[model samples]
Target: MAQEPDPERLRALEARLAEAKGSKAKPAAAGKDFSQAEVAWRMVLELTSGIMIGGSIGYGLDYLFGTRPILLIVFLLFGFAAGIRTVMGTARDMQERQLRAQAIETQAEHSAGTEG
Candidate 1:
């Protein structure tokens, strides 16, 4: 005949299952944390790429027009302006994100304070 399961063993299994589920329910915090260095690097890359792309386009135009230094100089300045604009945009985005994060943290704290 088949035997019945023991009550103690069933409780132990349920406890372990609940513990595992609880652990998994917590959000993964590792990916969200961006260090200052990483943020700076991201901004720097954005600016650099903008400048490089602008400079390349300018260089190509100068070569096509046979204007030599004139177009090159103009384009280089344009590229610098474009890069500054991109960097400013990146800074604004980062600021907005930081504000939102702070708001969330503040809300969470307020809720916790109210609960206790």
Candidate 2:
């Protein structure tokens, strides 16, 4: 006579299978759900922070040197330039990351196709 299967073990196996199926469907939806607003906000934050930090440093230096306005104005402009540079750098980095991610995904698909 064949041995009876354990109900507890069978339930555990079913639960694992369901969990695996659920997980496989989530990542695609998560990727699609990513918003452009997030990227915009990230760049804005980077640019704003750079400008603020540079301006503060310039102001401090001006105060220390007892120069009323010249260094402050110069450093403020420098800070604005720095902020723009930072935003551009951030944009480039983001593009690179996106390209890398796409390349990885393409490679994965190719390998999967070959294997199948």
**True-vs-predicted CA distance for residue 64, candidate 2, Å:** 2.7
Over the stretch 20-79, how does candidate 1's per-residue lDDT look in tens digits? 887423344624767889989988897788778877887899889888778777877888
Per-residue lDDT of candidate 2, residues 57-99 (tens digit) = 8789889999867777887788888888988997887788788
Using TM-score as the measure, the top candidate is: 1
**Candidate 2 stretches greater than 4 Å from native:** 1-34
What are the per-model numbers of colliding residue pairs? 0, 0
Top candidate when judged by lDDT against the true structure: 1
103: Cα error in model 1, Å: 0.9
* Candidate 2 minimal-lDDT segment of 10 residues: 24-33
Q: TM-score for model 2? A: 0.60
